[model samples]
Target chain A: MPKVEFNVDRCKGCELCAVFCPQKIIKLSEGINKLGYHPATVKEMEKCTGCAICARVCPDCVIKVYK
Target chain B: MKVVFERPRALSDVTTHYCPGCTHGIIHRLVAEVIDELGILERTIGVAPVGCAVLAYNYLECDWQQAAHGRAPAVATGIKRALPDRVVFTYQGDGDLASIGTAEIVHAANRGERITVIYVNNAIYGMTGGQMAPTTLEGQVTATSPRGRDIKQAGHPMRMAEMLATLPGVSYLARVAVNKPANIMKAKKAIKQAFMVQIDDLGFGMVEILSTCPTNWGLQPAKAMEWVDEKMIPYYPLGEFKVPGEVK
Candidate 1:
């Protein structure tokens, strides 16, 4: 099982993870959340290899994955 | 193969009170590592800021002083002026340095104070419920800037490293990010260089590290680093902004 989750309210919309990810699976949806920022979305769940590259690059420690 | 990543000898064994995934702990380790490598544990005195790292003295194994909000640089100035032989430094955050202590930093640099400043720029006020800090990017929304940071209303994000580099009294200034391994290595080198500047009895030196504040920025730790790399980097580019002996 692979789980991807974000504390939606905490997204700063920096979009670095999506840019740095080898798979490029992460994307920021135009949809606004409660925090009103364009939070990132895991658009391609199938492509996620759980390498945790996004986790390593994040300064806020907002992403978590379970494999 | 086993690698030990515990606290450095220059740092105490006490666990940091920083939130999980907070980069302050990593920064503390980096500074302590530099202190250990330079063998200035006994003679080093660190002045901590009143932000999230206010209790830094408890974690670092050396002489430490607690300064008021944004006053670490001023306190460090006094300490270094009195004890010219001791290596003195100040650990401050964006809110501390770019905001409240702006005048103190300017004067310190203008006077060519021989001290190192480890400036952590996380964009928002980390410990203070994610307020809009002086380094917060334009259009970036914070608790105080829910409608997004307007350039007209908020002025602009202050780039301390670039600003300080122009000061003639400043001998070294570098801006680095800690969002990944490569950048982290670069950041460590920059920090070491700042310390070495003081060790050589040079004038003011500072290493501004682009850090992340997940809790404040409302992003997962991973996304926060990404933001730092993408948005923050574009505004506050990384690399050595200033150094004495660099061939143009």
Candidate 2:
């Protein structure tokens, strides 16, 4: 299984990662962060390939992947 | 667990001030990753331009110099000449480079300065609000050109990579965009190659990265990324215009 971690506070809630995710697992949290943006989080970690595509498209570099 | 992808050491942990969906952050990370991979952080000196990316020095941990508006190439040239052993590069925006610092870049490339240049072209002045830039597409509405950019008055958008490729001193010149995941990988490769050219002591190398300004473009971050594909790419096609020993 692969793991993806996000510095949620730094996320700009641009939703780019969610759109680019191949597995369609990342989603915005129901709550907002300090910046008042709905940061993205993984909904189904088991499906992630750890391709880092989410991280690559992130304008804020908020995600890191481990495989 | 072993780390497959993480932040690059060459990039500081400081949160950038770029607007939401702005691709400057993506481009910055690519450069930092290239610096880390090339093991040139210690010798890398970057010249920061006067635009939205002016705060680049704060995010990139390299020893950086602040260049006067539209003089990043000139400053980079001076730095490379003063420290020939060091790897010097300039990061400039479309407004700063294409509009204000055109002569500086033309001369720097013609002089064959052994330096890397990361040119971010968003086609609008992002820092001081959305103003029409030298690379703005024809009929694109912006703050300065509310009626849309008039081709008669503004002329066509400048294809800087191709224009700079004409110089005999150029070692490498490529135009890459950061609109999607695949393009991001290609952009990283191009940026790394540009730095390699400098390290190999080749002539001036530059990578013009088609970037996004979501706030200025008045579109979602993702849509702005698509704008690069649907709007910008047709006029400024992506390709390696020049390569060392390949072009005359």
Candidate 3:
């Protein structure tokens, strides 16, 4: 199992991470973040491979993956 | 029990001012990761350019100096010469590095200054509202080039990596991109290598990153990345233009 954390406020809603997630577990949140952008959130935490692909593609450095 | 992916210590906690989908944040993180891995965070000094990354100092957690437009290489040269023991680097954009700062960069590379330059070539100028830069592709429409770039009037786009590689002073030169996971990894490695060149006192090293400007390019973030692959890469070509100890 792996853990992924998101710094919601730092996210700019680019969705690059969500698009790159190999497991397809990340998605934009339904609500807006402080920046008025829908920050990414893990849809199914269990499906996350902790591959850190999301972190790699994120432009905001908002995602942290622990394996 | 381990942090597999986390913010590099060399990066500040504050949020960046880059627009959504801007690759500047990714490049900054890559550079910070390199600095952290090399343990040069304290000894490293970054010179910020006057373009979109002008506030680069705010995001990077290290000693920084703001350089005038297109003068980062000149400022970096002064810093590196004054403090040879310290690792000096410059973060510049196409407008700052390729256009206004072309002479400065060329001379610095020719002189083989022991400094690292991270140049972002997004084709169009970002901060100045999407104007055609020196690296803008032919027939690419920007705010200034509304009808697409007219090559006859604008001339051909500059290939700084290839141009600088021809100089004997440059010990390392590579062009990379952050459009995908694999490319991002390669880009990080190249950045590390560029910094290592300076750490080893090799010579001038530069990594030209083909970045995207979603807001300016008038395309979705993902589409802009694809544009880099379909359009920019064809013209720019990603690979090592030069490296230390390699046969010419």
Candidate 4:
């Protein structure tokens, strides 16, 4: 399965990854992170195409994609 | 599993100080990615300017020097001359490069300094709480230009890429945006070419990246990217303004 990983601590809850994800699989978690902001995560691992668009538009460089 | 995308080796493993949606981090990542791809991480020297990106040394894991407001090109010139073999580049914002550091950049490029300039033109002074900048578009509201930029009062916005393209020393000059994935890819290519100009001992090279200031723009992160496409791009049109060999 294609996968996407988030360095939760580095995320700023910008939602840019979610906004750019072609599959719309990235979402912000309800839980606050180390910096007190919601971090983005993959909503459906199976939906990932490993396009890496999320990683490309992430302002904080929070996501890494694998296939 | 094959990794499609990962952190660039040239980037530092640390959180950036940028706001939730600022595009500066993205630009930093692109530069780091280019450095790693070109295998110039070991010899690259960056001069960070006094602006929102002043702490660029924190994100880009390389030998860096902090230049005073708008003096990045001057500092970069000194570094390049002192260590001619090293790849020297300067990362500066519109407030630093277009407003305060205008003379430094003009002279540096005019003299054909073998240095790469990564100019981030977000239009407004992002770190200074959205103040008006030299490149701020006409009729654009900002902390300083609350009523919108009046062309009569402030004159027209500066087209840094086109203005600098006329310089005889400029080896390469291009303007690109990072609002989307496709544009970001082109941005990376321009950045790589800018760095290559320095490595090849060509004259001054600059890649004017049209970035976003989401916090100051008072828009959502996503909307900010859209604004770049809807507003900034039309005024700034992305393309190569000058190429080294095609001087004619």
Instruction: After superposing candidate 3 on the true structure, give the runs of residues whose Cα lies further than 4 Å from its correct spot.
Output: none
What is the DockQ score, from 0 to 1, of model 3? Answer: 0.83
In candidate 2, stretches whose alpha carbon ends up further than 4 angstroms from where it belongs are none
- Residue B160 displacement (Å), model 1: 0.8
Per-model root-mean-square deviation over C-alphas: 7.8, 0.9, 0.9, 0.9
lDDT of 4 by residue, B1-248 (tens): 98889999999999999999899999999999999999988899999999899999999988999998999999998898899999999999999999889999999999999999999999899988999998889889999999999999998889999989999999999999999999999999999999888888878899999999999999999999999999899999999988878763
User: Can you give the DockQ of every candidate in the order shown?
Assistant: 0.07, 0.85, 0.83, 0.87
Candidate 4 stretches greater than 4 Å from native: none
The better-scoring model by lDDT among 1 and 4 is 4
> What is candidate 2's local distance difference test score?
0.93
Q: How does chain B score by TM in each prediction?
A: 0.96, 0.99, 0.98, 0.98
Model 3: how far residue A13 lies from native, Å: 0.9
Q: Candidate 1, which segments miss by more than 4 Å at Cα? A: A1-67, B1-6, B246-248
* Candidate 4 residue pairs in clash (backbone atoms < 3 Å): none
Over B106-204, each residue of candidate 2 has an lDDT whose tens digit, in order, gives 999999999999999999999999999999999999999999999999899998998899999899999999999889999999998999888998899
- DockQ winner: 4
Reference contact recovery of candidate 4: 0.81
Least accurate 10 contiguous residues by lDDT in model 1 chain B = B1-10
